[model samples]
Target: MANYTDWNQALIDYFIKGTPHGTKIYLSVDEDVIERIGYHFGQSSTNVIWVNDFCIAVRIKVIFEGQVNLQHLKGRDSQGLPKGVAFLCATILAASQMAQEEKTSETNYFKRLREILALDGFARPLGMKFGNEAEEPLWREWNRWLMEDRFLPSAQRGGGAATYINYPISQSLLRRTDKDRLRKLFQEKQWQAEWDAQTLFAHVRREAGAFGIHLKDLLTENKQRHEAIVEALHQVYEQWKAQGCPTADKNNYCTWSRHLFCGLYRTEEPFLGQVDYYLYPKQQRGRSLESVEVKQGDNLHLLREERPGWYFPLEYSVSQKELDNGAKYQISSPNDLDYLILPARDFWILIPDAENPDSGAYASWQAPSLGTEFILLCKQELVSDIERLRDEHLLKSSCTPQPIFNNSGWVELQQCMVVSQAWDGVFIKNQALKDALQPSVKLLISFSGGLRVPKIGAWLVNHGPQITIFGFYSTAELKVTRLSDNQIILESSQSTNTSIRLDFSDPGHYLIEATFAGESSQRLVKIVDWDELAIEKYVHPEVMAINSEYHIFGSVIGQIF
Candidate 1:
């Protein structure tokens, strides 16, 4: 008679050869052995029947006929069988015992088998390819069971849904020792179904540590950091809401904060702390306009910064109509009233008038909820003009405006003053005065004093006929060159306040060039005859002729009155 181990090996050998369809095998053994084997076969398959207690009849069904194939183990002479075969035998035994107590469907039978295999760490050794069509559904069902059992810890929870961290419970990472301990706990029903998130996490933490797993590296630290960031952002949101939820647009503040929280939560860095909020069109006490520098692009400005990198801007712009009507800005309509989120090193807060704190219409405006350190307020009309100029390369990236001439400069004719005011406002309305001061009439241009020449260079005056230029300079040089003839009309070097004169005896264009310090500047001068003035047609009674050869400020002043 064969011993128990011999009978077990014989059964394994029979299955290894592959079960054939409609085949029956009879084995004669003791009552105890026959009863045990008969019970297991009856539970696992319907082909087993009792042919007296001493002998049993077994038949392979069509569905499971060719499923068992362990021919690779034919020549193995090892004392102990492989874990996979041991697990298969143990599964049949356990199923037999379970089936006798409670009947289950085929689907439940497969699920129970998978659970046993997974708990014993024999799933991988059994070479079960989840990619196989027959195994795909079972694998999915296994995953579903894991989720339902709360074996995975929650990473985040909100909106009646939760995301779980599955790495700690991944099947591929499970060790035999770990699986054994887990299997014991599961069989003992140590886990409670009513456990909360904290309680579940505590259990997971303890088990993970006993399993030689690093919870901190996998999930604990990340989860804790995420929670802390969410809390911090929540506080910030509350404060922002308390402040009326100021934004460049109606809903943009909340939207931007949501995006910010998401980005900050995923990162390893700490939250944004101690942000400085600045409002545009609001007077900054003791801050001078000279401290801000205008850039070429629309809404681009710079300021002196001690900590440059931390400076950022949340800028808003509005159309002329909106500004006048006091309409709120919107991010959707970029051309009308819009907002921009930009990362910058420096920025400016532009008010209507820097000298008058109360001049700005948006003076009472509040800061944005995100706490902007840089902000700008610009008219809508100017925004397009700035963009156009920038596209055309007409504006330099960085430049300082320079005054070329003083307000006191005047134009004269034959030593008689013709105009002594800004040219923009001067117009010739009196024909008598216009004909008297024609281009044919010899003219003289004079710069009396206070010529606001830039310290780096001299002013280039483009004038017609004789002209006298006077200014106070510590040390300067003046030069006049005829462009047509390339002839130097006059060149002078002086160390004190001096006067320079150039004479144009004929009608043509002359180049007036000057140098101060180490820099030089030049202008074109056009001299014309009196007949070229077109005095009769240009000189009008009602119209203010700014195109006249000679601008008479006296007439314009009279006309204004």
Candidate 2:
């Protein structure tokens, strides 16, 4: 049996052989260490059958493998095994289990571990191998472990006994060792004796390099990078203060851009375009010709944050005779201009004019919903346009409205549909009811959140690329149409004047309401027939490039609007 002291020395020898450059490998093994650590392993045995950590844990199964090999701490075979210590370090590091010492930080330890482990089988071929210049006592000790199971051990197989094989302990447990304990272990003479002053300096230099710091500056008599970094920060603050102290002086104000200041300032009226208090059109264009009249208090204004090339809400005079038809704006408070808060990069404080409340506001609003029809329109008009102008999603993929239709007009590969919110709205017509029954067809409804049924009417023709029949109804039934496909059409009577095509072969989502004559329906397009190859290229372009620029753009921003 290998005594604790002999086993300790065996482990030390195994580690020392790998430290060609004399890097200290810290180990905390003592007379009572195994017993103390055994508690953590949920074992009562003081013999330490195994040691484990979060990253790598191993049990010392036996001294060696059958009769073919005896497991010495540093033992290696012709095939390879000598670099066990180095391998252990590697396993620990990859598991992020290196001890808490900054000197032995995971990165540094991992780097050193790699170098030593690489020596296993290759060292003998390199000639300056294990037995070169070996001392008598050291060899005796190593052989004792390999043979008599005193320092190392042999294996037991098929009911036979073996001894001395050292397996890795739990890397997680190793990392959990207290910082002070690790430091004390490093202070051992075995660790200090491995390196001379020069080797120590080199080690320090290597560690410094990992942090991208120069060794000379790090070890110099005076503190170097620390002071310089502090000075740089101070200079930045001084410059910012001198530049009018813009955001620093205002309350609830923060400057997101170094060149500009933005935030809410006090307002004189609640109706003032107080960005925080009022909601504005998410998008806006200049008002129409006749709609551009400004009251006595209203004047063409530019927003401080909304500048040269940016599109945002702003007052502009439509009067052809006015010289100041459009003028750049300066930052002003609510007293001067009522501002509404709209969410942007953070939040954009916008100014709203009461005289012409809708003056700078957006016109022709589209209903906000996750229904299939909306998604299809967005993919067609908005996504295509955005991709054409800029090779990116018009609406970022992160915020793209999810389609409500099961197939969702668009096909998704890895993309997942998340209905972050619930909505009640119009649905498409039912094909079964369209042909057999009356002119009006009722649609079966289904959706995630609880919603009320809505009354139906042809709200707008050609609302999107396709005509939309607005209906007042809601339901949770899985199937909407009598036909397997999710299609709904206007009852026969309502379809007479509509120029919209009712050709649909897939399922859909939307609202439908029962009427005395028949039924009214708003349709949600489930899957519009699209070239799969074209869509794939749009969704993932480099893989499949459809020959059209339109397809290219659509792929990038398929849900722009």
Candidate 3:
């Protein structure tokens, strides 16, 4: 019977010789480790069994097989057995008895516990090779617990002639030996190891010349410093102040600013914790960016950071013409300077003046509802347009030609629609719907965010060509029809997205009719030859002669808009 220490060393030696690489290998027992059973197999050591998530399975096979092999090698009534064969037999029998005592279920930890004890003396290595077919499930089993260590074991498995297969563990700089305790601790700290080497061989066969070697010999490295974070924030503030800050500023992304928020960390192998930390920040759940630094010349608009993602000065766009003197505007508030507070998540858009028919009103109007109100203000210069309003929706009825102290003027207050409101902001939409809204030019005629215009892929009328189409409507459904034959191409009831793919069996000249919110429009196109570069090249005799002599290839295929 081999002692615990001897068995432990024997298993490690077996792994070094029998298994493939030092990374992490499958189940195996060397002939040497088993042959030694005759010398010291019956002795017992004080050390208990330790098993990791993966090798626990491997160790189970080794323990069970060793037990069966020992039984077969020595008879029950043998007089002179191996040195510790009797002791080994007794230990295996004890484990079998313990395993039998435990109840069986879908997840029987007791059975596993017995197996773990049977092989605890030997080291069951943890760690895995990502970027491979085998190690995916092993590393992705996040619920299982793993022990931390000083050693960084790499399984090159380069699977090449030159790839080395040596597994080595380095000495620890700081030692820690703690027994298992309840409540797993979540240690969130930065690492200070060379990551360049790990990424160096990551998915081997990376262009060797492309990546130059990097060396970091730091006597002392400081990652998280309060002074550093504050300095980085101020630097961002100064940059924002320098630029004549615009209305919107989400395009700015500073690496130093982000680094200050999250300190540096390093790891040899790709760990889930590190990956999660890096990727979590990228999921912006809201309508806009996390936060923006806005400035406008000397008049810097200061905002109070009440919460993490609350936005002020809503980043709606406006043209220079709207702000010009003697120009008109339909604004949400009386003063353009009045800041807009918005929630972190919602659908938002800047409605152009041409699309909004309600902008025809003159005076400021307010609609109150649910302890809040939505306000709409018209520019003073828009009085001329308001004066022309004779429609009942624009001006109130039953007005008499009454004279007033203020002559040559008329004042008529019209009704405005009331929408909901919350702590973030108010919502408003007018009931005065336009009979014929303009077509969407800014809003694309795309096919699921792709291909704004049709392409002729077929060479002749008999060949088939694919055409993708999409359109969006604000107030009502968008109906797209083939105008040449009045065939309805596609219909999207409401909302933004409308996608469809069409395959023309017989190609020819065609026109599409698009009716959006009662407004009608058309797009004319033709499906022609796709083989030659250009129509001119095939038609012109001079160009064809040059092409036939040279036997050259070039693309003169201009895209249709």
Which candidate's TM-score is highest? 1
Q: Give the alpha carbon lDDT tens digit for every residue of 179-273 in model 3.
A: 00000110111111111111111211122232222100000111111112222223333222223222222212111111111111111123432
Model 2 bad stretches (over 4 Å):
1-336, 344-367, 372-561
Query: For all candidates, what are the clash counts?
Result: 1, 56, 10
Error of 1 at 323 (Å): 10
Question: What TM-score, computed on C-alpha atoms, does each candidate reach?
Answer: 0.18, 0.15, 0.16
Candidate number with greatest lDDT? 1
Candidate 1: deviation at residue 483, Å? 2.3
* Candidate 2 vs. true structure, TM-score: 0.15
What order do you get sorting by lDDT, best first?
A: 1, 2, 3
Clashing pairs in 3: 1-40, 1-41, 1-42, 1-43, 1-84, 2-40, 2-41, 42-84, 49-120, 50-120
- Checking candidate 1 for backbone clashes, the offending pairs are 440-530
Candidate 1's TM-score reads 0.18
Where does the lowest 10-residue lDDT sum fall in candidate 2?
156-165
> What local lDDT score does residue 386 receive in model 2, on the 0 to 100 scale?
27
Model 1 stretches with alpha carbons more than 4 Å out: 1-473, 495-499, 538-561
Q: lDDT per residue, candidate 1, 333-452, as tens digits?
A: 222212322212111121121112232221212111111111233222233433333344322222222111133111111111222112223333322222112122111123322212
